[model samples]
Target chain A: MAVQITTQEAVKKIRDKSSVMIGGFLGAAVPLKMIDEIATAGIKELTVISIGAGYRGGGVDIGKLVLNKQISKYVTSHVGTDPNLIKQIVNQEVELELSPMGTFVERIRAGGAGLGAVVTPVGMGTEVEEMAEKIIVDDKPYLLFKPIRADVAVIKAHRCDPLGNLQYKGMSNTSPVMATAADIVIVEVDEIVEVGAIACENIGTPGIFVDYIVKGHSYQERKNVYEELWIATNKL
Target chain B: MSRDYIAKRIAKEFRDGMYVNLGIGIPTESANYIPAGTEVFLQTENGGLMFGPKPERGESDPDLANAGAEPITMLPGGAVFDVATSFAMIRGGHIDMTVVGALEVDQAGSIASWKIPGKLLTGMGGAMDLLYGCKRVIVAMTHTDKHGNSKIRKRCTLPLTAAAVVDMIITDKAVFRVAEDGLYLEELAAAVTVAEIERLTEATIMNIGEWQESEMS
Candidate 1:
């Protein structure tokens, strides 16, 4: 059974220098309240694994961590969207390790499934091959990437039952896999319902993978957050 | 030639029922020009597939977004999944075509679009995987940089996204088909001359067929 916890309590589970997996693509499906709490807690030297840098501009979503200098290492597929994060990576302030987006997600899937590694030909003749071990099988060459497991995973979902069955409304992105690949999974959801409320078929993440649940902003509130940011950044 | 012209030309590559992935920047513009009455499903690495056009300002959904993180709408038959499944569709060669922006492309059909060494460090994102797995890979970019240096190069100076993966190159001034032998000029923008193209492009035009004049309107 997963216990309901406050966002502050959820952030307390993360420690300095911990390898943390943040589940989201850009700002969509991101755990904003939990990310804010983690930033306010001032945790430092984190090895943050995410799909990309935060939303397009700086100082939003996971970009807040970059502004706070909380991350020492970033394992991501892209950083071009966030200028602050790019500056950190360019200036040697944050060590950056990148994998092609497909390969990156496969590695996390492999971790969750208890696989040793994944081999693919996607990066055979590019700079990505330099970052991994090359193996040949039956005269065919492939790059092998090791699985990635994190100490804690922070994810967002649309709704959750009291027992922690998560249901996602739109793009789930990396949350489902991150929920399984971490030792402690903290999920932020917009609403909490009865244990039997979420149908089994609708459950995106089962309670077995979740450790704690934190209530997040409502749908309208979340929409307002992005709308305000978009207007402020002149993207609207 | 304008960016819209480049995108319009690239959009002709889409076949009915094709599942296409569009990379960020100019490649995203190709979606707006997808041929009328051609039902092509748009796939985004962020997890949505068969997504439609951008939503109106006040009608946007925070949860529904494209790979570029811009608000988007899903078609009637669209579906959403987790990131792992999304990439599986990409790496498993389920995507029919992909249009991407490039920093440089060489005579060998190799592309360099992800990095610029110490100056810029944007990671490859999904370009490498898309180029390697998609049935057809098309590059949509300007013919030259702002300094008038050709981006179609004899050899790319930047890091490679993938080698020998580009099937077609669509630029503001011309369209080139990448064959196993070499690059072949297949079309030219209106009012653009072969002499001008030869002077600007760094890569040798292996063969110039009876090239068609591209429609500007």
Candidate 2:
């Protein structure tokens, strides 16, 4: 069973420099409130791994984090649409470690599974391989990609029972495996109900994967409150 | 010389089997003359490759795109791959060449590939990776804007893509190679005179004497 916590408590639990995997690709089905909490906490040097979708978050989701100066480095797939990331990287304002989207997912999954490393042909003879270690297997050289792990996982869910069973409502998912790998799995949901209220089978991630549940605050009149969050966070 | 003339001249530097990443605008036009069957592979930072010709209307694949976020069809022998890996290829030093346009280039070969002084722009797409990754870089642009300010200057006053990665400069006025010695003039557009080209240039350019005419495919 998971404890029911307010959004602030959920945010408070995450320490500084903690690695967090925030869900959603291109902003769909993302955990806006939890992200807001993390941004507001003024956590320094936190590593955020996500698909760059500041545009769909009504702007890039992590761009606000970058703008707010909450995060120090990023392990992301794309930041093309995010103007702030572009400017920062161009200006050398932040440290960015970029990986391919598929490779990024594989790294998260491989980390959770306790795999030491995976061989990929994606970055061969390229700059990504410049950081790579080459190994010979059967007389052919292969690039060994390292495993990635997170300290905390901030995940979004459509519904969560008191037991912490979760249901994801969206087209696709990103960095879900980091939930199982991280030490603390904090879940933010649109709605929270009783245990067993959600069908046992429909839950995408079982309750065992979650450590805490924070319910999302809905403001009917002030739509897209997440956008206002950056303005507030930047003041901090 | 002009931007198109420079682009056509820069197209001559393409060598066989060179792994290349092209930037947007006039530099993207160099795809038209990739040595017919040079075995060159084009990478776009956004996702896919359109290494060959601009496909006919219906022949394009909506899913396959260039670094510029435009729809494209791959050249023959092209394969589909993930975007991150594509960039890894760029960042990993797998590319042999990068040909892109420049907003500004200083005498020392420092480049500005992103942001016009006052306007918000689309920004760099693999330009940083291409700048630092590829072994050879060629910039294609006119000698000056229609407004007549040098794109080639003493220093780049704009947001630079990467430090100093330029190996060659192909301007509408002439073809200049960035040698250890200096900017050496290799070829000239027929209409432009060597003395006129030298007067307009910002740096001490080497007139490697004259070379052949350029035909942009």
Candidate 3:
């Protein structure tokens, strides 16, 4: 079972220069509350591992950290959505490592499963192949990518039981893999229920993988964050 | 030609029961032109298989998005899985064809789509993987850039997504099939002339004069 904690306490687990895995696809299933707490704490020079850039541009979701200059390095599939991050990357202020979205997900999964490496034919003749080791299996060539694990993982879900069983609504993008690939896993959920509230069949992430659970901002509150951002940018 | 006309032409290449992957940009529009009663399964690299067209405004689900993060809907027998399984279908060569947009394509069919020097790019998402893994690679793009420069180059000056991998190029003005010799002009857009295509193109387009828009149903 996981203990219910405040977002501040959850943020404390992440220190400066720590490598963290964030679960989301453009803010859909990201841990915005914990991320906000970290940004407020002014932690600097962190390494962020994510699937894509934050949604709708700067000062929103993970883009806030990019705007704050808290992240020194980012490993992601794409950064087109955030112009701030793109400017930083262009200026060489922040180091960026690019990966295929599918390979990035599989590398994290390999980390959790205690696997040595993953071999795939996805980037055989591209620059991605140059970054990896090539091995031949049964006379077939494959690019071998190393496993990736983080010091902490912050994830989001629709519901979490007191035992930390997570149930996701729309789709579980990177949460399931990040949950198992980190040393400490913190989950932010919309609602918390009693044990067995989330049936075993419906649980996307089991309680055994969670270290801490936190109640995130309400739906309306979270909505207001982006709403205000849009108004401020005159996009609405 | 309009974007929809390009999509409709590309849609005709899809065979029933073919598992297809559509890349971002102009290739995403082909889903709207799929022939009715065809069982083509649209495989998205972001973990969606057999999805329908983009949803109506206000009906879009943030969670159910395509590779471009635009809201979409799932069709019958559609299943959503993690990224690993999605790429397994891709990298394992299970997909029949994939449609992608290119920044430039050389005469040898090498594609350069992800990056251009001196420009800030969003980085390659899954274009390289699709180019390397799919059985057939169909490139869909406008014939020229905004500056009116030819995109069909003798050699790609930009970083390549993949080399010698493209099977066919379908632009707004023409269709060229790659062969052992070089690019062969197989089809032309409606009312487009061979001389006009030659003037606008940087690569040497061989006119085999076989297929045309009128010959296509």
How many clashing residue pairs appear in each of the predictions shown? 0, 20, 0
Candidate 1 segments whose C-alpha is farther than 4 A from its true place: A234-236, B209-217
Output the better candidate (2/3) by TM-score.
Answer: 3
Writing each residue's lDDT as its tens digit, candidate 1 over B33-82 gives 88789989999989989998877778778888888787888989899999
**Alpha carbon lDDT at A102, candidate 1:** 89
Query: How would you encode candidate 2's per-residue C-alpha lDDT over B84-128 as one tens digit per residue?
Result: 456567666877888887878866677876556446444243455
lDDT, residue B147, model 3: 99
Model-by-model lDDT, in order? 0.89, 0.65, 0.82
Best by lDDT: 1
lDDT of 2 by residue, A1-236 (tens): 78889888888877888878886544434577777777778888777776453542233455568777766677775665677766766676656776544456567777877898866554443345665678778887666778777878887666789888887542225424656777888887777878778887778778888899888754221123432432333310
DockQ of each: 0.76, 0.04, 0.43
Candidate 1 chain B worst ten-residue window by lDDT:
B208-217
Model 1 quality (TM-score): 0.97
- Quick one: ranking by DockQ, best first? 1, 3, 2
Against the correct fold, how does model 2 do in TM-score? 0.52
- The sequence of per-residue lDDT tens digits that candidate 3 reaches over residues A1-236 is 89999998889999999999998777555788888898898888989998888875656789989989999999888888899999999989899988777788888999999999988877666677887899999999988989999999999887899888998766577888899999999999878988877789989889999999999976556545534543454433
